[model samples]
Target: MHKIKRDDLVKVIAGKDRNKQGKVLNIDAKNNKVTVEGVNMITKHVKPSAGNQQGGIVQKEAAFDISNVMLVVNGTATRVGFEVKDGKKVRVAKATGKVID
Candidate 1:
């Protein structure tokens, strides 16, 4: 199972947004990238179209490498570790040694 999922609170560990926390908006498993809310935002210009009534510059969230962000655990952002428990893989919160759901 993927440690990061939609709606998970994540902290940016690398790049310009480092140390900032946001909710996970989406995850792209095929590319191993994730888009966090309010992080790595990019602006795009679009022409007026039927689907879009107001066609103009729009700010959108961009996907960043999954490795660049870390999950926040127990009020702190920490790296994730995993181990086998009861014949199943379980995620461990590195900072607190607690099992993460």
Candidate 2:
């Protein structure tokens, strides 16, 4: 399993959003990018369509390099590490050495 997954809280470690924190909205492992809520905000210009009655400029979260974020556990920003417990691999928070689900 990947260290970072959906709904995970993460802190931006680099780029213009440095120090910002948000939940993981999506993950593109193949492209090595992740979309975080309220991070990497971008504007999209769209025309009115059946799906969007008043389509106009909209704000959305954009994907950024996964390496730019660190998983947050218990209000602490920590690196994730994999460890085997009871023959099952689990995520461990480096700062507290606590299991993350």
Candidate 3:
């Protein structure tokens, strides 16, 4: 399983959005990238289409390298670690040593 997953709260540790925190909207595991809500926003100009008659410049979140972000645990950014719990491997927060589920 990936250390970061969809709907996870993450903090951008690198790039233009450094230090900014947002919820993960999607994860492109194959590309090692993630799209976070309200982060790495980009503008796309779209022509009018049947789906969107008023298509125009739209601001949306762009995917960023997964390495650029860290999981937020207990309100702080922290590295993830794996541990054996109840005979199962589980994620843990390095900063607080708490189970991350």
Candidate 4:
């Protein structure tokens, strides 16, 4: 299982958005990139479309390398590790030794 999942709160550890925290929006496992809410935003110019009547400049989240983000646990950024408990494999916070999932 991946340490980061959709809807997980994470902090950007590197890049222009470093130190910004946001929820995971999407993950592209094949490209090793993840999209975080309100992070790495890009502006796109689009003509009017059927779905969008006034499609002009739209701001949207952009994907960045997954390695640039760290999982946030208990309001602190921490590395994730896997452990088995009750025959179930779960994620643990390396800094706190607490189960993350």
Compared with the true structure, all predictions reach lDDT values of: 0.92, 0.96, 0.94, 0.97
Least well predicted 10-residue stretch by lDDT in candidate 3 = 1-10
Error of 1 at 65 (Å): 0.8
- Tell me how far candidate 1 lies from the true structure as C-alpha RMSD in angstroms: 1.4
Q: Please give, for residues 1-101, the per-residue lDDT of candidate 2 as tens digits.
A: 99999999999999999999999999999999999999999999989999999999999999999999999998989999999999999999999999999
Cα displacement (angstroms), candidate 3, residue 40, comes to: 0.5
Candidate 3: where are CA atoms >4 Å away? none
- Tell me each candidate's TM-score: 0.89, 0.97, 0.96, 0.97
Per-residue alpha-carbon lDDT of candidate 1 for residues 30-92, written as tens digits (9 for 90 to 100):
999999999998999999999998899999999989999999986799878899999989989
lDDT per residue, candidate 4, 1-101, as tens digits?
89999999999999999999999999999899999999999999989989999989999999999999999999999999999999999999999999998
User: How much RMSD separates candidate 3 from the native structure?
Assistant: 0.7
Clashes of 3: 0
Q: How does candidate 1 score on lDDT?
A: 0.92
Better of 1 and 3 by TM-score: 3
Q: Which ten-residue region of model 4 has the weakest summed lDDT?
A: 46-55
